[model samples]
Target: MRARNQLLDTDEPGRTVLTRHLPLPALHPVDYARGHAQFEARSDQRRRIVGWLDARLAEHPAEAPLSVLSVGCGTGAVDAPLAAAAAGRAVPGAVVRWTGIDPHGPSAAAFDAAVRHAAPDAEVVARACTFEALDTSDRFDVVTFVHSLYYVPDVLAALRRAVAMLSPGGRLLVLHAPLGALNELAATLAPETDGHPQWWSDTVIAELAGMGLRVHVEELDAEVDLTGCDSADRALLDFTVQAELTDEARPAVLEALRAAARPGGGLRLPHPVTAFTVRPR
Candidate 1:
């Protein structure tokens, strides 16, 4: 039987996202951690999100507790930071209940441990399920999709679901890499494995705008360091492109990636991140 709300690709109506295949290594925690570390050094959007949330919470002084639903939240990297920030804001008896959903069980468990370590006072919940499979009646004051939109079967449908999950005046935050060096390199290195559509930052912005929602975009500048990385790291980087390049392609790929790096720095690829804050009209 067909799922009631399955996300079907427009171009391939018969092909749903459920049957879509993805690169296994791309989801590896080690790769994700390494990539996230590089971006963390360059930008502080996590803190920025905290400040944004603090201001929003200030607007509703009566709302003592804020519910945050994080889709594709992994390892408490971003969510835990936000929780720690929320704890410090100390919104006079502010209780933040954060529920993070990720399909990876190990990552979800790690997230639980990390949140406990980072924000012990903050209430945290982790669910091992994909956002498409998540079943929850509870809505949230804030919904976030941080670097996880690409995996969604249908971007537009997922955005609509995010809208439905929000309370009145609630906000949705999306952080993703646009058509920058990483994506470009991915295309050049492994064109055959680019299964996901090129729905970059602009595509998302336009989609949100078409829905009559208010959207704010902030670009984060960063670089992915390839210097001193071992072979395993290189494999992970190849996995990101969803293609395992051959020994022949490796040299050229490395050359291009390194050439794009900042002068005097490691093979730093320009990774421009975009943050979108969306709200219903």
Candidate 2:
């Protein structure tokens, strides 16, 4: 059985506190760097997604070039690798056009800089706007939301927008680690903390099916092993924990993480991601 922290009585009604002070750990700069580094490291996964899209495009006898739009494309992580893969392809005179969109203030400039640094020749266009904010006149062969769907206030609406932007036979992909089992575990361990919203899985599939889109959902175990990572690589973990937990519960969560860490060792957390591929009917 895991050691449990004793709960303390608080004068405030319906409130309880821990006896010990639990400070959230600070993640190392290296950890912050790893988020960006991991994107580049996952070239094979990017290629697989791009290849899948290419195959789908090939299935149709479309004479025009393939166009791909990546929604919520943060820092051009997915876009850069995808462009590289398309450029390396042997498609005879096949032009691959790419568009990256994000509502993040710095996304456009940051993505442009990253793409120029990585794949200068790639046809990449980026906009600092959300799917809902974008003009509906544009359509694409492939549209993807990579780990950014959760941030949307109305996931169903955002998904609908994505599907609407797909050209005939076009594919819409949603890639993120579902917070199902992990969320349950976290809630069980710490009920005070609000777990991730339940709508992520429920609405995405339902909306896709209702719109007459053929949906393919796959659960992929892409765990990030932080055991060998240094202190610099743990900052995101710390910030994430602190950001998610309330002040009263923050310390306990940090303490829990501290307990998970081995002596003179690093920590490992499960990162199970899910990918949904929806093709027009």
Candidate 3:
């Protein structure tokens, strides 16, 4: 029996379908960097988020250090980049203290390493704990869930939790994908996985609004280049969509990908990311 990490069971059919269909392996940071460019075109959301944080910090003339809480911070992927961006945009005397929480032990360890490498002077704390079970009394200036909300069993509850952790005038930033062509393809290939189930951008926005939180959304246009990618790269891309096609369905999946390919080279997949900022009313 495979081990279960808190609420996520790695051996479950929905989560392990890709492992059954492909040679799953731990991806390096470089692989992920390319993967980001493959599906998403730019980092507009990240820039906008950092810029907003910069302005928020500026509002506090005291130059007090900022505190950030990042849920499901996988290897500090978003955390590191965000810290770097915030540093560049921060005014004098601005210091950011980041706390990352993730259930995966290895990911937490990697988060520590990545954060240190990215921002040598920043204070970063990595904790291995599920978001639902996290026990902390500290509030934060910013709370973010970047492409990590789906892992939570209760998306609404998770949002509520994050919102409750926000300090006065703090912002809750959530970056999630809309129901787009790429997700549609994944659903087509792995209907059993429920890959895109009930967690699209619209649902999140509606949920926040229902809770009386003011929300604003920004959509980022993204594209991926698969021109020179090898079979491994293709497999990695498929994994992004949570698609695990059987031998019979593999042909159809490939055909659909080809249909979405750009005229020149690579696939012109639709990667529309929505960034929502929630503020208490």
Best by lDDT: 1
- Candidate 2: segments with Cα more than 4 A from true spot: 1-64, 90-92, 181-199, 227-235, 242-251, 255-266
- What lDDT does candidate 1 reach at residue 162? 95
139 in model 1: Cα distance from truth in Å?
Answer: 1.1
| Per-residue accuracy of model 3 over 234-266 as CA lDDT, tens digit each | 545545545433455454455546666657666
Q: What lDDT would candidate 1 get against the real structure?
A: 0.67
Clashing pairs in 2: 27-234, 27-235, 28-232, 28-235, 31-232, 31-233, 177-273
Candidate 1 structure, TM-score to reference: 0.77
lDDT of each: 0.67, 0.57, 0.65
Clashes of 2: 7
What digit string (tens of lDDT, one per residue) describes model 1 on residues 1-281?
11111222123443323122222223344555555555455445455555654564445444367788988887777777677766666566778788888987878887888876787877889999988899999888889888788678778899999999998889888887787655665543333212555456776877787788888888866555566543545545555454544555555455556545778866656666788888898
Candidate 3 has what TM-score? 0.74
Q: Which ten residues in a row have the lowest lDDT in candidate 1?
A: 1-10
